[model samples]
Target chain A: MGKRSARLENEMIEYLPRMRRFARSLSRDAADADDLVQLTVERALTRLDQWQDGTRLDSWMYRIMKNAWIDETRRRQRQGRHLAPPEAGESVGAEDPDFDKRIRAMSVERAMATLPDDQRIAVGLVLVEGLSYKEASNVLDVPMGTLTSRLARGRKALEAQLNPDSVEAGHDD
Target chain B: MMIDDETLIAFLDGELDEAEMERIAVAIDADPALTDRLERLQLSDQAVRETYQPIAEEAVPDHLIAAVRQADRDTAPDSETVLPFQRPTGDRPSRPAWQAYGAIAASLVIGVLIGSRFGLTEPAPLHFEGDRLLAGGVLATALDRQAAGAVGEGDTHVQLSFATDAGGYCRAFQQGGTAGLACREDGRWVVELTAPVPAGSNGPIRTASTALPTILLEAVDARIAGETLDAEAEAAAIENGWSGDPD
Candidate 1:
């Protein structure tokens, strides 16, 4: 491989874990998420010329993944396939003291899944992936204000579901 | 200066200018209520990060690595000029073109299963007794002996076992290259749905139903009476020969 291609490959490998996590958040099933990540990496590698120098490679990859997920969802819609219901808080950890924590985590994931696709992506980018607001806006191709509003709305929804007492108390102020 | 939640969030994310960040810092130091709000936001951020932190520790599937390697090879300069008769060395033996196409077709079936999250793939070559699909070959043995949480080295592995709402028991199994869910009806394990197992997926049985393929998971969701059986329950069920009528 050329030095440039090798560098790109290394960078993509480094991004794989985060990409898989983002894909899992977007996709309902683990298999589908991995497939989406595969497709995203393949597309990115094949079209590396499109990526601008000096830009964050992770952000560029995030954009590709987001677009690929959108396309896949559209295709599924056109095919009239039944989308899986949101995960219903299936406990992840084996029988242990940490099981409760795992259950809470599952509930959080389920709540995140309930958000609208746009809001979910916004939250995933900003809160989950720790992307800067500007970088998230760039990935979503939205204005900064739009991104912030979406994040606020998504965070509010999450707080309502995950911590109703605190959310209610905050609302009184 | 009164700081709004969005501005506070931006400041937390380091999205604001240095001046704005300093102002927020001073305001936060001066105001107890604002400090509480900022702490809440910070906690929420930490929770979100922690929720997905486990995925980073999960093993990467080898098939994905192979795909990346294949892309690298395809992009190499001499790859285009390689002789047709010359096969690549150090790789597994190449299958016939038809088998390659068959794998692609199976992959597409798996894709459909992933998208719809429920449905059966094309049937493998299993002996059928009338219309009722009886577990044959490795599938039959796995259904007979494998416990829900146990991970067997054989080609057929039973991943989960639980009771259906109909008072019958169902088990999810992966055999050969496909994964599926089967419910016991009239003493026979009837196949619900099967799809090609994606590459590098041979790991321990997943405790999280979320990791399951949508179709298999949907079938489980539709039939499960309550929560899936815990490990102790599953072991007892296995001991009882997976009798749908659990005591």
Candidate 2:
């Protein structure tokens, strides 16, 4: 109805896809990730003043998403055992299911999930969201050294799993 | 100083000093392996970026815009009135009382509607819990180590155990009373229960009296085969170095 309302609405519209992609990275399931992003949008709108102009909007939204996910995770704990996929009888690997591609994606996702929450947050911000290290540290509320160590270890672990071949494989790849 | 992979990732991420980048460039030039790895890492980063790049290019959804618009409208009035909702003690008690009564009634009705539709009164949190919960410390550590069918002692508690049809072990877990689930992947436990489970279930009876919660039962069903791990079987799984099919 008003100028500020219209501008905020436009900004939210612009953020959907990026928010969805980040949600996807956090949640491997397409549907679940979309739900998470939608929830993020709803919450960010509800708490509009919390967001300051000139701050990284993506990071702020991400903080909301992370908090939402954490809450969801806790709620699910009561009966949330990992469900087994239907017994497809030897579940053929997609016949050219691109096993390597799936493995690569899963490997990276799994390793990233394993990182301590703060480190994972940092990795997502810096490596995934393209936030600078300084920005990530500020977002994560950690000392630069702490953030660096976490990032370094998280990167190394991911490298080891995602590309475990040459001596320098884990180092860079 | 000679650069390592950590330094290389830092460099690629622009965390490195200019001197460090120059040093790594020299080392990369001298070492074919380093150069190849750098190229691959860059390519991987590029690929991840590319995979998500389309999101930035895609059109934003309309509903999200509408929600934000509605929120802004709601806030505008509050912005104008420094204490819009607060009672004016000096006003005619009857007039203020009626307004207060009306607001309270409206809020109560809205709350009830939300509760029923979303199962908000159910045992679990209806929405996000802010920062009070998420995997942390020892819980994070244990999830990293356990794979399907394996259970180990220590910081993490395996509340329930099951085997996947894929022949891997999966466990419904809790850390400091916060529930989660992790399954074995590539000989390591990978967590999959970091999101909320949808409402309703077949309501399976849990053997562990103090089991994490029923929300995690679906996770167990998803991966458990045969009977669940009894105390003895669970102990065996832990004792035998945690090697077995989750099924």
Candidate 3:
């Protein structure tokens, strides 16, 4: 490998963890998420020439994964295969001391999975992954305003689901 | 000026200009309700971050690493330039040049159904039980004993082993032009998704390659729970006869 390719490989490996996290949110399943990450890495490496210098490599990868996921979703939809809702509150290891915390986390994940695809990606990128609005917009190929709206709606829905008492008081309105 | 939820969100994200940020900071300081709103939003963001934090800490599976490396190798300039038959030493001897050429040609056409990868000199009969295709003959033997990522003597190759959300162990396998994802359920390897390999596609099924077909990968993904088993776990699963929770 040339110096540039070596550097890119290193950088890609460094981003793998975060990429995996982002993918888990988008894919809502560990295996699928990792597969998405793998596909993203493969696509990025093959199209390294297309990645413009000075732009964020992570954002470029996020775009690739998002697109790959979209394609997968479309294929599944065409096959009439719907995602079965994840089994709720699947135990997170028996030794875990923070059982409540784990349940709450699983709840959030389930709630996030329930969001519409666009809203889920927007909230996941901006709120969870900490991507800036512009970066997320670029990743999703949406305008900034569209990204913000999705984030707002997703966040609202998540908040309602997570904090039902607050929502019962009409806080969602 | 009253801050709207969107403005507060932008403020939280640090997306606003200096003047707007300062104004929101002042407003937040003066207003308890606004402060509560900001805190709630921040808490939600923190929760979301925390929920996904574990995934980052989990070890990346070896197959993904191998795939990336394979892609790197594929992209390297020398990869395309060097042929399997090309040798540095000009000493051409034992076998005829035509034999060497034939070997090279065969390797080039590795995954075609008629090629050696399929291991079919004559048409091999396919056995099926109703609509479910049972892995009989060589394919069954591979599923019964072959370790993942290990090239079996038979045409079938098991690629990955993982635990499905349904509490079963599933394995992805490929044999020449055929590939599928099978899960262990009710004491049998149930084929979840199978299809004939597409023409001109370099998906993992066609070769001992790590690049998985999108459809097969999706099938595996839809079923798997946490990450696929690493090498050690996969070996153990195979030893336990593909039972995820072998008692």
Using lDDT as the measure, which candidate wins?
Answer: 3
Each candidate's interface RMSD (Å, one decimal) is 12.1, 14.3, 8.6
Candidate 2 residue-wise lDDT, B29-94, digit = tens: 898877777776775565445444444555555444444444444444333322222123343121
Cα distance off (Å), candidate 1, residue A140: 2.3
TM-score of chain B of 1: 0.45
**By DockQ thresholds, what CAPRI class is model 1?**
incorrect
Candidate 1 lDDT tens digits, B105-194: 343344335333234643332434687556643455557667653433233456567787778888877543456788787666777666
Score candidate 3 by lDDT.
0.68
Ranking 2 against 3 by TM-score, winner: 3
- Using Cα atoms, each model's DockQ against the true complex is 0.13, 0.14, 0.20
Summarize candidate 3's per-residue lDDT along B122-148 as a digit string, tens digits. Answer: 222233467764444455556767776
Candidate 3 local lDDT, residue B43: 72
Better of 1 and 2 by DockQ: 2
TM-score (0 to 1) of chain B, per candidate? 0.45, 0.32, 0.50
Off by over 4 Å in 1: A1-4, A79-84, A87-97, A169-173, B26-33, B75-80, B84-247
lDDT of 1 by residue, A1-173 (tens): 21223234546666888888888777656678889889987787677677786677889889999999888878988999734456433332223268667766776676677778788898889887878887799999999899998887777667666664564334421
**Native contacts kept (model 2):** 0.35
lDDT of 1 at B207: 18
| Residue pairs clashing, model 3 | none
